[model samples]
Target: MESKLSRNEAISQLVLASSSPRRKELVASLDLSLPVYILSTDTDESIEAHWSPEQVVEQLSLRKANAALDLLQQKQAVETSLIIGADTIVVLDGDVLGKPVDDDEAKAMLRRLQGRAHEVYTGIACVLSSSGEAQLAHRMTKVKMKPLSEEQIARYVATGEPRDKAGSYGIQGLGSTLVDEIEGCYFNVVGLPLSLLSDMLATYDIAVF
Candidate 1:
């Protein structure tokens, strides 16, 4: 049996269009032999009010991937690399809970999420730097938060882990204590769904072997 398989020869590298440390770490876990580059971009993330969670994440992810592709083109360094972009969001009671601006907002978001189940959506986009070929997909996970008290929420908020996280928590960090149960890809809640991402990469002749 073969322990390794050949990949697309034309594809020379993998470019991640995000600065999130968690995402970077997840990509590193794949351990692909190709060189991986971090080409973060400041793409506009705004969306229409009526867009559903799926639409919101998918569009934002593709937007970032395209922005990175443009940057590579301008530098004339787009030598058959693959650009990977992703976006994750938390939805509760039909409302999107983005990153909190302050501790008060974080506590408020957590308060609403306590003792309830919410959905997490993670969208992934892959663009071939050479031919401009693009692929997009998303994964949804159901997360149930344990019932939390005001003091517990306050204590967690003081830890400062929820500051930049959606739904005021990071399931992969200290926030794990707050979750009662989860259904679907665990990586989806972390930020980038590994299974979904691997599948998309396979379409571009990239495999995890």
Candidate 2:
């Protein structure tokens, strides 16, 4: 009985390795007994041109999780940590769209995305600090956008929401107006897939229920 209690205490904390408000909110919604700690990492996000979209997000998520683990180890605060890292990307016509650097770029990405169906791929990685074991997974959602005129795209860009979002739109915010339909996990497009995360957490003895 004491051993079981000790194991529970060992995984009493969840470290989220991301700066995304959407991800933070999603994880918090789980209401797990384990306290959540946000740890954002600025790891390298560049990917090879030939890598598949799945590979891109998975590798990036792992990198972010590992980076966060390194930070916690340096601070000597990782003894009871289970770190999660996630990366999302927008793929249209075999091309990957990342966060735009400027309004013009955002506009261009939206332009191509308008009146089309694109796939949103989000990868999640969980690293157990005590065991140094990492698990990775990804979710894909097909999103169809409403046809928008140049004026509409310009107006959306003016709001400054797309500048920091991949594919130049956020489905959970004002950008929802631009989407006509989605065929997979909605939370995946929001930057984190809760259902998938919950399952991964279970593997580490972290239960939401």
Candidate 3:
């Protein structure tokens, strides 16, 4: 991947189009110190029954990147900007569980997730506004949750921590207590798959180290 990056002559244009602090921290952890700029566009995350989990996240991430690309072009910065967008979703038993709508919903989501292993898919998309070039990929991690009683689930939901997270929990925060084990990239469940993003960034000549 390093060799491929060298071949592209390197791309210095970097921008993030997300409001997620978790993603911001994940990106900063690379030591890039890059600027994060949110896009003016909003996405409707409703998924169709026909789409696979990968398709759901890939489309959502690409939509966000495209929105950011549009914003950059509006500012006439298209040629000099590389915009990134990412989306994550939790899948259990072929069902997609997004962020909870309320505390009750959060508890319900957690109840179904307890004692079960679910697949978390995070999609990352990078768009070079110059020449309208784009690349998108999705990574999946299997996360097993510790069994929880109704009381435990209700308690976690009442903390308001799970309301804003997919699958009603965050593996990188206080919610980490609920996870028993993870089968793949740990950062993926946190919101961004750094290793996967590093490789994806390489295709655009963006290096992390």
Candidate 4:
């Protein structure tokens, strides 16, 4: 456990290493009461293509965090900031589905996921810039999509909400209507996992409350 921050010093320096708007919104709502700084890192997301979903998310999350930290150091901007990096992926039948590259690919991913259950795995990493100390973790959520007719899928796809999302769905947006039930962290499917994030921050002298 870390020492609690004083109200006078409560607004800790934070760097979120992600380009994801969904993740930025989710983290903002936590109200860590810190001076949050959002960073969009263009980290290489490619992997071996054969790694398990868990392994892939974990490695990618760490890479994003480290990449952001490196950038900060290069700029000599922040040495004591708490850095966060994360990645989310949809897995079905052992295949990892990342953000779709185009409308057609998004449609194909949605077509395959409809009327079926899939897993959303989100990996999170927290690193202290000063000490290079870090902790990493991941959460898995089971999401079951409602059976949709060709018309329903086509209409949803036409709306373009699925274009940039994994598995061609955004649970926090129009895609909510497509999910029948979810068996894990709701935020994980939305792009970040709050409970998992809160727990990780505890080690860095930050508290969500």
TM-score winner? 2
Preferred candidate (lDDT higher): 2 or 4: 2
lDDT by residue for model 3 (149-181), tens: 999888878788887898989888788999999
- CA displacement after TM-score superposition, residue 74 of candidate 4 (Å): 1.7
RMSD of each: 3.8, 3.2, 2.6, 3.0
TM-score of each: 0.94, 0.94, 0.91, 0.92
Candidate 2 lDDT over residue span 71-130, tens digit each: 999999745788899999999999999999999999999999999999999999988787
Candidate 4 positional error at 37, Å: 0.2
Over all chains combined, what TM-score does candidate 1 have? 0.94
**Cα miss at 184, model 4 (Å)?**
0.8
Candidate 4 stretches with Cα past 4 Å from truth are 1-11
Question: Per-residue lDDT for 131 in model 3?
Answer: 52
lDDT of 4: 0.86
With candidate 4 superimposed using the best TM-score fit, by how many Å does residue 200's alpha carbon deviate from the native? 0.7
Q: Global lDDT of each model?
A: 0.90, 0.90, 0.82, 0.86
Q: Distance (Å) between predicted and true CA of 32, model 2?
A: 0.6
Name the candidate, 3 or 4, with the larger lDDT value.
4
Residue-level lDDT of model 4, residues 1-209, one tens digit each, is 34444211332588999888888998899987777888888899998867888889988998999999999899997447888999999999998999999888887888899899999999998877876666789999999998888888889989989888888989999999999999999999998999999977776557798
